[model samples]
Target: MSVRIGFIGVGGIAQSHLSGLLTLPEAEIVALCDISRQQVEKAVERFNKEAVGKEPAGRKLEAAIYDDYRQMLRREKLEAVFICLPPFVHGEVEEAVIEASLPFLVEKPVALSLSLAGKILDGVLKKELITTVGYQLRCGSFMDKARAALAGKTVAAIVANRFGRTPGVSWYHRQDKSGGQLVEQATHQVDMLRYLVGEVDTVYAAAATRINNKDNPEYDIFDSNCMTMTFACGAVGNFGNGTMAHVGVPPGLNGVHIFGDNVQVTIGGNLRIATPDGVTEEPLDKDMMVRQDSAFLKAVAENDPTLIRSDYLSGVRTLAVTLAGEKSARTGQPVKVADLLAAEAPAAL
Candidate 1:
């Protein structure tokens, strides 16, 4: 049986999810929710244009647009929903999904603040609903190879550097809205580090807003930040992020380099795996997001939690690490992940 999917916050990322879902035969988008009527209409028109040449005569595209997600959820009998809204809006949507006993896939960072992230976690625990987060990089073939290459070996240190154009989203400039680049974009690298290595125990960070003045006046959020993390496994990690790279550089140049006892692995847009025996370069595959979508659909079809690549708990742990780094940056002191999580009680769902 096909799974009916509803999407909340029909924006650029929602469009990407729609594109990914179109590739899965067992998944069908039945409804879309966005605040702007124009955006909803535009999305419908675009989908119609794309479907005209492909779908069979009788298999018409079936989707209704909504301005309020609660109304969409109330009116549509959907098997699953994808929360593609901004970070600040995620907590409430997730709580509603859990209460409705519907499976959901939320985009990264989970929530804009630690308190909301905790709340989402509590709701998930209470509802015991199937959940996944958008950490698509974990589905990359190169990342898997990199993880295997580092397993069982003592990781001495990890270094990640990410540089790119300033985020085009309006919320990118507001810390309360988007959680800045550390939580918004750099969280991917941070999560990868923890996935490849182990749980992060503490973080020390420094940050500055040296550039992107035109786009980010007041500069409440940092344009660049550096963090050092201590993992429970005794390995240390250093990560740097900058939104001020020259315009000539590609949109995103992000990579993780792992130093281990036997092999050193670096994976990003390009892949390089090195060991004592030899060095090999793995070709970058462009199908990571496609594979991620396929995995999520497979999980939904089977109703098996293990099939989901990044579950809700894993996403929360990663969010905690990223948020810890943010706290460290702001306070000029080292922050512990456990303390951060403990300080904020989950929202009452």
Candidate 2:
């Protein structure tokens, strides 16, 4: 009854997903696909070596490596796939997955552009597939407590700041490929805002590239961006994203602050949820990928879309919000998420 899982894109994020899948008893990583043959071979070899003392009899870790994901999909009896490909390539792969009628878990920034995102959403709804997007912050206990404590009370405002070093990948620096800081990285915070509050209706933003120019000439993508958002429920949010943090800062050292009528939650190096009653500091567990993977597997087994928290449709909306912010930054005007999606129809793709 174990679900056969195939991993596409053996990049850093893919490795995190792979590590988590290895711990789940209801699932097994049956195949690996990547554009780089050497990386695929290395992944297979590493998994085999690591399996020596862990895999069950006749169930030793074995994965077929492939250079093309379509070939892997065609050849394997895969129950699900975890796509960790770059943002620009996400739409087509997701379209194919939808066509195949298989459950999939796609990494964040769902698509590079709004038009492509809409097309992916159309395909997903047409196929009626179960999907989960990689917005793991929603799975955190601290985030849950924040949501609960802030309930019933009107949110006055929300402020979130994320500062970290640039990713090592060259494509990550190019706005054309990754959609800049807001779409590529800060989409998580945007989605979290929607989850904790409500859907966003309008966005005004400003962005600039302040660093990593030497290594990236096409890095027109923002190294820093700040956005002001108005939610459908009339609440307002302010968010800042940047790659300005020194290399020495821990990955989670980035900051997020949520303010409500009675509660203010501040989470950064550690999880802290506070209200007028008292303050509680909980150490954030660094196992979001594992939690996300387990949740996706359970959804797949049960064939329940509701169980998949961040399904493809919701992922598309979040992507639209982030992309609208990007457009707002570029145009120096506030952008409506609905209008942005309409203007960039699928024909542009």
Candidate 3:
């Protein structure tokens, strides 16, 4: 039997997963929910258009649509769910999903704050639900090569940067809704740092909202931000990001550069490594999302949580690091990731 699936949000990220699911024969999305009725209709139309000429040509593409996720969850019999909502719209929906006892795949920056993310993580663990986070960089071939190149080398310092234009979505610019660029956009790089380096111990950040989009008052997120991190392994990381530049323009580089004793690895447009002998470079494959989606579906289908690369707990840690960075930026003091996570644990949860 095919794994019945439901989507809690129909947004751009949801399209990526929807496109991925179209390629998988074992998964069928039967229910969709979003606050916008137009978005829900558009999602249904897009899915049907893509599914029409596929192998399952006769399969029904029409799905029940609801403006509220709770109604969808209560009415649909789903084996798995995809929580694709914004960072601010997290807590209650996740609790409801856990209550339903269905495996779920959530997009990253799990919540706006570490306390809320920790609360969600506690529920996920208590219920032992299968979960996957949308940190696709962990599933990339570039990461695999980078890991192999740094196997025996002692990484000393890491540098990560992201230069991009503001998101088209208005909510992304609001720090309360999207958790700023560090927590929302550059999270992939932070998670990549944790995945490639080690867990972050402390974060010190400096940020400013210099470039004001006078037209939009909701644009309160920082335009330029610099963060310094100390890893548990004693490695230091210099990570910074800016929303003042275009994403694909010149001087806009986004990726991690790892430096070891006598070796250096750069992962951006491509994966490159330099040693005493020579430099090796390979174009990075662009199928990480496909691999990510495949893994989550397989985990849900086979009842194997091990298939997922970045699960809920790991995502929560990444979220904590970003939240700490945000706090550091606001307070002008270094914040410890461990302390943030420890303070978030509720006695009952």
Candidate 4:
């Protein structure tokens, strides 16, 4: 059974999701909605070219574009949707999707305001929807080996980093819009940490706009941040993130290193493992984004939430951790995730 997919935002990330979704035989990219009609038109052009040899029989790559998602939600016979809007613009579309009882795969970080996130989460709970967040970094075979290797072992600590270039988008340069690199770009690493280690309980961070702000006067978000975290499993973690990087930064340096009993696992260009005897390397054997897209569509087709690895609530928790880091950076004190959620979330949430 093909899932009739509609996209809420046709930005760069949404286009990436579209690439993976096109690979699935059971996916039909039927409609698109974006605030910019030109962007949606460009997406349609790309889809027409890329989907020609891929679409199933009797299915054409005809995605009707719309500016208002509510109109798209009402007019289209969509089975699932991809909500790829920015962090600040998340609440209404998600709530409407849940109200319509349509399953969706939303990109992270889920929201900038926890209150709005809580409300949307509450609606998703009441509707019992199948949702996945776009934490595509944790979806490939290297990660599979890492998970299997740590199945029974207790993870003692994790050292992660996301030292990379600033995104080439206007909204991304502002802290109020994208929640800085920590909440916008590095949320991928943060989600991977939560997925591999455990749930975070508290966080303390120090951050500043060191270099990128000087280069671009409009840029206000921090380019350098270092955070300390405590997990529910009594594990400790250190996260370092910066957006001042140029082209020379090695890809392996921006990933994570996890430590446990006689085990040291590094997840970067590949999965590297050391267990007292020797060190071994495992390359990322597959395209992770495709795997993530396949998982979401498969789960939606089967109506089984169990197949989904990361759901909406899990995304919310990850958002809390990143937002707490932002708060901690401002206050110069440790921030508890629970307290942050409780203060911002509604009663039902």
lDDT at residue 72 of model 1 (Cα atoms): 92
lDDT of each: 0.82, 0.80, 0.86, 0.86
218-275: candidate 4 lDDT, tens digit per residue: 8989999999999998889999999888755765787889998888888876789988
Candidate that beats the other on TM-score, 2 or 3, i.e. the better one? 3
Task: Give the number of colliding residue pairs in candidate 4.
Answer: 0
Residues 217-302, model 3: lDDT tens digits: 66899888999999998899899898987436465257789999788999888888999999999998887887898888888888
Ranking, TM-score, top scorer first: 4, 3, 1, 2
Q: Assess the local accuracy of residue 66 in candidate 4 as a C-alpha lDDT between 0 and 100.
A: 91
Model 2 regions lying over 4 Å from their true place: 54-60, 214-216, 247-253, 342-349
Clashes (N, CA, C under 3 Å) per candidate: 1, 0, 0, 0
Worst-scoring 10-residue span by lDDT in model 2 = 340-349
TM-score of 3: 0.94
Candidate 2 per-residue lDDT over residues 299-330, each given as its tens digit: 88888777666877778788888888888888
**Lowest-lDDT window of 10 residues in candidate 4?**
51-60
Give me the overall lDDT of model 2: 0.80
TM-score for each predicted model, relative to the true structure: 0.93, 0.92, 0.94, 0.94
